[model samples]
Target: MKKLFLLGILSLFLCVLVGNVALGEEEKISIAYIGASTDLPFWITLRNEARNQANELGVEFIDLTPPSMDAQAQKNSFDNAIQMGVSGIIVGAADSRAFDDSLDKASEVGIPVVAVDTGIDHPHIASLVQTDNLSSAKIAGQYILDHMTRPGKVLIIGGVLGHQTGDARKNGVTEVLEAAGVEVIFRAADWLPEKAYEVAQNELAANPDLTAVFAAWDPGAMSAKSVVAERGLTGKIIIVGFDGDPANLKAIKEGEILATIKQDNVKMGRDSISLLVDIINGKEVPKYIPIDGFIIDQSNVDEFLQ
Candidate 1:
């Protein structure tokens, strides 16, 4: 009887040890990621990549995007993540200042916040993972200058006015074009395809002789391309944009877009999560982590497309 009792006790102890090990292995660290909009393929790809990376690391990633690029919707998402007690947050803020309060609340609750693609101006942000927008824009601008002999009027299809990425790209192009003595005709688009199309139509209507069009993003550029084709001005106007989406690559192949800047979005997602993980694990993180971008033109579109 005594021997049997001892065996039972030993078995219970072993079971407890095994259970603890299993629990440790199954321990999930929850992370929240919010983007401007999920409708854009670029953001979709970025979120998927981030989720895949989180899964590999035994982390739970919750991705949220507003129905549109609505600031209040993004703030609500941030608030929801905070209420759910997420370990960390990675946000591509719709507006830099819109999330300041929510970010502060997250910080108060001891949740580290990392910004990806777009940045929050608040100091409480743990880190920022984004491309060097200005440098990428400069590459596109140089390509345009080289492709067009001497400087004629070029249309600048600007993105959402206040968004950091859009503003940076516009400023970068403006700087480069001015330096190269190119006349820039400005037009505004809300970063929506429809809005971009309208802007493109208006620009073409005003400046039919425009030599080139520089769009802040790929979708906007593609929208502009469609309008250019509709107006029967395809070969006459060169189109350059940021973000080397696969569709953009196809456009380049078909001789629609001249060039695009390919951001390391996958790397951006991976690095942002890694940085947040480090902070959660009590490691110090840098305030800014800038990732560079590459220019994809006809000569190198094949490389990115493959």
Candidate 2:
């Protein structure tokens, strides 16, 4: 009878020990991604890559992108993710300064925040993963200066006026073209294709002899290409773009656009997750990670397909 009682107690003790071990095991990390605009292919591709990387790493991924490019909406999403106790956050900021308070709150609560594509001016950002937009924009500017046939009017379709990425690109292009004595007509399309198309259509009709057009973002470039094609100025007016969207790749193949700078968006997404993981693991990470960009033109556009 004593032996039976001892055996039962031993079994109960072993079960408790096993349960404690199971409870002590590390839980899967949860990552929250606050994308700027889901409507943009660039952000969509970035989100997809980040989600894939999170899945590969056995982490839970949450997408918190706003319906549109609304800054306040983005901040609300960040706050919600923080409230949900996310392990980390990868954000493509809609506005550089709008998320400062939410980022600060995340930092205070020990949830690391990494910025991707666009960056904020706040010190709370754990790391920034993006391309050097200014330098890449200069590439397009130099191409226009070297290849433009004449000194006729040149138009620039830029992103949001005060946005960091757009401002950097516009400044870079403006500097290079102004130094080359080219007349630049700058317009902000807010990164909207329809608005870009409207601007391009009106300008193409008015300026007829516009020498070149630089669309600082991929979708804007796509819209500009449509206007140029409709006006029968496909090969005549040099059209350069920024992001390497798949449609832009197709446009390059069809000779609709002259060239575009390809930002490593997949790397941007993957790196953001990697850095956040490192941070979560109590490892040091670089504050800034700059990915390289490629200039895609007809000569090498075939290799970029697929």
Give the best candidate by lDDT: 2
Poorest 10 consecutive residues by lDDT, candidate 2:
20-29
lDDT by residue for model 1 (1-306), tens? 999999999999999999998887556578998987888777877888888888888888898778577778999999999999988998987777688789789978899899999877887788999999888888888888889853478888886678788888888888898898888877778677888899888878887668899988889999999998998878778999888899999999889888898998888878888888888878998998888888888898888785
User: What's model 2's overall lDDT?
Assistant: 0.89
Show the colliding residue pairs in model 1: none
Q: Score each candidate by Cα lDDT.
A: 0.85, 0.89
The clash count of every prediction, one per candidate, is: 0, 0
Worst lDDT run of 10 residues, candidate 1, spans: 21-30
Over 1-306, each residue of candidate 2 has an lDDT whose tens digit, in order, gives: 999999999999999999888755435588999998988888888999999998888778999898788889999999999999989998897778788778789989999999998878888888999999888888889988988987798899998888899988898888899998888899999887899999999999889779999998988998998888887778999999998988999998998888999999999989999899999989999999987776999999988899
Pairs of residues at least 3 apart in sequence or in different chains that clash in candidate 2: none
Provide TM-scores for the models.
0.91, 0.91
